[model samples]
Target: MSKQQMIPFQTTLFVKDTCLCLHAQRAARALARLFDEALKPHGLTNGQFSLMMSLNRPVPAGMADVAHLLAMDRTTLTAALKPLERRGLVIVAADEKDKRRKVLRLTPAGEVLLAAALPAWRETHATLDQRLPDIERLRADLRALS
Candidate 1:
């Protein structure tokens, strides 16, 4: 038999052009940069804004729920919370119903900050939606993929 043929460079280009994961990652980075710039006035990166937003609820949320909702592991979620806690924007305490379980809550300060941040996020997201029509459907599709 002939020597095994080497993998072709064309295959590399094929994957680069055709891979959904690659395209999704690139789009995610681009969107992150856009939102980061938009939210800079509030001293929040897009990730921090999203993390804080995840805690906006009628009740203090459990770490696991927030982590799962954010697609983050508990360790990563804990690390993400540290800066916000240091800033006194969020508090982590034992759950009332289950004392051993730590729950996350936004403080009054955090609520104020988030309220201020909302307009920027809304405008930026609206602009993005304008550029990408049917964005709600796109969001639903992306969620399905996730």
Candidate 2:
């Protein structure tokens, strides 16, 4: 048989667009870019801002706890934190209760940076909210999906 005759093809027109994932991905990328641009003056990426915010709790927390809270793997969290640690924005030390586990805490400098980044973050957040007034509904929908 010829190649065209040998091959079989199925045709269907009911493939509905499940573009929710794509839309979410694009929105995430765009938001990240906006945050990155706003945070540039403070030398922080959106991820770093998130990490710092996560660490801002009253008590120091174990790396495992942070990983769980951030929905990030330990290795990935460690890699992301390295720059902050190196820059004196964060401190990683052995957990007081469990010597084998590491605890993460924000340093004074980290607090300072977070404070500086807050205004920029708020600005970007407000701008996005104003531009996309449906964000609250979208956030609710996203949370429902999660």
Candidate 3:
């Protein structure tokens, strides 16, 4: 390749050090692992826990709404629901008023497990919150980015 087509090694180093996406992804994975380990006894991953938590409302949440709240596309959210559905932890069905629309809800067993898992989730979050400086601000910034 010609020099014009080459990206300098220094540029790679700069991106490695300063890319927000890279940093955020690395942090996300690490945090997922931490929470995954904490939730293992409950047979839930961090993502699954969050998904179930999203469905813990009085009314079954619309699939699109849950997808938006979780920052996931419908297909990805549907794929993620497979294991939970298989375990009877969540129910996905067509909305009553709109047959074409889908909705989701946690089962009674899922609620019980979520209640049981709350302490571990709280403790992990508390530890992370204590370790991070100005976590609220960090969260706000992340929200803004999203």
How many residue pairs clash (N, CA or C atoms closer than 3 angstroms) in each of the candidate models, in the order given? Answer: 0, 0, 0
Per-candidate TM-scores read 0.94, 0.85, 0.93
Q: Can you rank all candidates by TM-score, best first?
A: 1, 3, 2
Model 2 lDDT tens row, 91-136: 9999888899899999999999999999999988888789886989
Q: Which number leads on lDDT?
A: 3
Model 1 segments more than 4 A misplaced = 1-4
Error in Å for residue 130 of model 1: 1.0
How high a TM-score does candidate 3 get? 0.93
Model 1 Cα lDDT, one tens digit per residue, 1-146: 89998889999999999999999999999999999999999988898899899999998899999999999999999999999999989999999899989999999999999889989999999898899979999999999999
Candidate 3 residue-wise lDDT at 57: 95
Which window of ten consecutive residues has the lowest lDDT sum in model 2?
7-16
